[model samples]
Target: MPTMTAAQRRDLAKQEFDAFLADCPSRLVLDRISDKWVTLVIASLADGPLRFSELSRQLAGVSQKMLTQTLRTLERDGLVTRTVTASVPVRVDYALTDLGVSLQDTVRHLKTWAESHVPQVREAQEAYDRRAGQEVGA
Candidate 1:
């Protein structure tokens, strides 16, 4: 009823941000994207479409079940296309969609950041571990 104060406005903004985070599918999306198999499958499609067997070959150490689940998630996100060709063997190919192509820049940036910061993060972890050990010893 009364005019809101600056602190109230800031609180409102923070609340909105928290609500947005809760509403966003970030956890589900990250659960799918952060997976090693999913990243490999998406990267494989970067060049062009590939049949299921081709994808399996390109991505080493991926189980067929894992690959299937990853592809389904990507397709549901509108990031990948799956086509079944009518043939004697009934081949299927997976390719990145236009939306998925737009994600390349983001993925590349993440890769760059990880490469640049991994050593720093490792150093911090080791320092913490050493301090923790000293406290335990004392």
Candidate 2:
């Protein structure tokens, strides 16, 4: 048997990569990218790199442990890079990779949609609650 080249290996991997499959590796990638922290972190880094403290401040409500975990996951997935600076306090920065940047526009659109549709969503929820109440009475 002949050993496959790098290109051949990549082709084979791509051929077998299917997100719809329960055990497919691509499904894990999808799960990671779909996480709320992942979305926020990626979107926050869209402009440029930010230190851990800065990111925590910008994200508002993210705990330090959660941020650290999300960053580690992003780094593991090759979506973000972590850099350490030789400063007085030793600053660590996180920045999106090219692959991460490719997702920025889509994430931004999702963010925008959520923000703009809140009122409509609230109205829908109220209507749903009223209907549920009527059904309970009936």
Candidate 3:
């Protein structure tokens, strides 16, 4: 039997990933990236590297624990890089890797879509609530 090169093996693995399948590994990755915190973190790091404090400030409402988890997950996924500087305060900075940078535009678009369509979504939700209330009262 012939041996497959690294590229060939990677290609084969890529072909095996089907996000539609419930058990597909891609689904896990999709779930991670689809998280609001992940989206915000990626978008925030799009411009340049940011220290932990800066990230927390930029992503208001994200708890310290949640932000820490999100950064760890992003780092594990190869999307972000964490650099710890040997300074007085031991500064830690989070920056997007090339892979993360590649996703910046997509994440930005998702954020934009949510922001731009909030009014329509709110109207839809109000209509749904009214219908639900009427059904319950009927």
Candidate 4:
């Protein structure tokens, strides 16, 4: 087989996004998606669009600043949409975009899996700690 030129290689790389590559742009997307706030926000929005206060109330312990930042990042990434309506009090709502909807199920499953496996994870951590302690003692 013939080898491609540097320009050809660069073109191919541009056509495909590989997260495993150190410099691939997909890593930035992965980093955003992997954030705990992103996961929770995606999962929360899966139900339906919610006002800012509602989303914050649903996600306990997430400070207002953090939530705002997460929503802005998500919006910039095209994973979520923000709608503003004029009312007695200016109203703003957050909803998942088509892309965000596609991602929500996967995030939901991950959240559910973590919640379901907490006991097993704790056991594994305990066992590892015990082994480490014994090694130190030895």
Candidate 5:
């Protein structure tokens, strides 16, 4: 049997930490779009830009506060563009940038993967809950 010295253990830990940090995608694109809501917002903009109200209506169950925060983050990341129009009143529209457009394929691939695994994942969840003696809910 082999044992690790203190120096060896510290080196290994530092190496693992560095690897983890290196593997993490930069905050530029992923920081905001990593969340489901932000990803969906970007996907919705694929067809075309949408007004704030339009987006709110399309994304059901999303509170106005969350939508606003998501939009702001997306804009900061340059994944979404915001424009203001002065008509009879004022209007705001959001559209995806070229960078954001590139994310569509990645998101689509993820969707496909999840859809394929839905049954397996649900069964696993049920099994885990049963093992834990948790109710499946009414």
Candidate 6:
């Protein structure tokens, strides 16, 4: 077998997932967590578990279909867990797994950043729109 050069050895030792690479597995995770519903759902569970109805109410504009899909995706990804209790109608609750809890700080920061940057984003959008309008009228 050919011996690896020191540089080659170092590169192999330092290999890590890079989302910018088209085939990196981390991109799948990035895609999943970056969804608006995923972010909101994770943020909503920061307090504790919530029932489907409760989550729907808390999430404002999310449709029942969208919320169900979001919850299912999160659960499948091991970031959340679903619990069921027998009742007049079976009750289901969704809660974060430890993996999900670990993500809370990042989720919180993202939510905060978006909330804080609304004015800047709006200004940028309005400016771009005005420029586009002028270009079209010119």
Every candidate's lDDT: 0.83, 0.92, 0.95, 0.95, 0.82, 0.96
lDDT tens digits by residue: candidate 3, 27-114: 8888999999999999999899999999999999999999999999999999999999999979999999999999999999999999
True-vs-predicted CA distance for residue 40, candidate 6, Å: 0.3
Give TM per candidate.
0.68, 0.83, 0.88, 0.88, 0.73, 0.90
Candidate 3 pairs with clashing backbones = none
Best by lDDT: 6
Q: After superposition, how far is residue 19 of candidate 2 from its true place, in Å?
A: 3.3
- Cα distance off (Å), candidate 2, residue 137: 2.0
| Model 5: per-residue Cα lDDT over 1-138, one tens digit each | 589999999987777545247554454445555688987787778898999999999999899999999999888877889999988769889998898888878877776788799999999999998877755353
Q: In lDDT terms, how accurate is model 5?
A: 0.82
Task: Give the Å shift of residue 40 in candidate 1.
Answer: 2.4
Models ranked on lDDT: 6, 3, 4, 2, 1, 5
Give lDDT tens digits, candidate 1, residues 1-138.
Answer: 889999999987777545257664565676667776766777778789999989989888888998888899899999899999999899899999998888766676666787799999999999999999999999
Model 6 misses residue 66 by how many Å? Answer: 0.7
lDDT of 6: 0.96
Segments of candidate 1 deviating more than 4 angstroms:
1-20, 112-128
Better of 4 and 5 by TM-score: 4
Task: Please state the error at residue 97 of candidate 3 in Å.
Answer: 0.4
Error of 1 at 62 (Å): 1.7
How do the residues 1-138 of candidate 4 rate in per-residue lDDT, one tens digit apiece? 789999999988775797777888888988999999999999999989999999999999999999999999999999999999999799999999999999988999999999999999999999999999999999
Question: Clashes in model 6: which pairs?
Answer: none
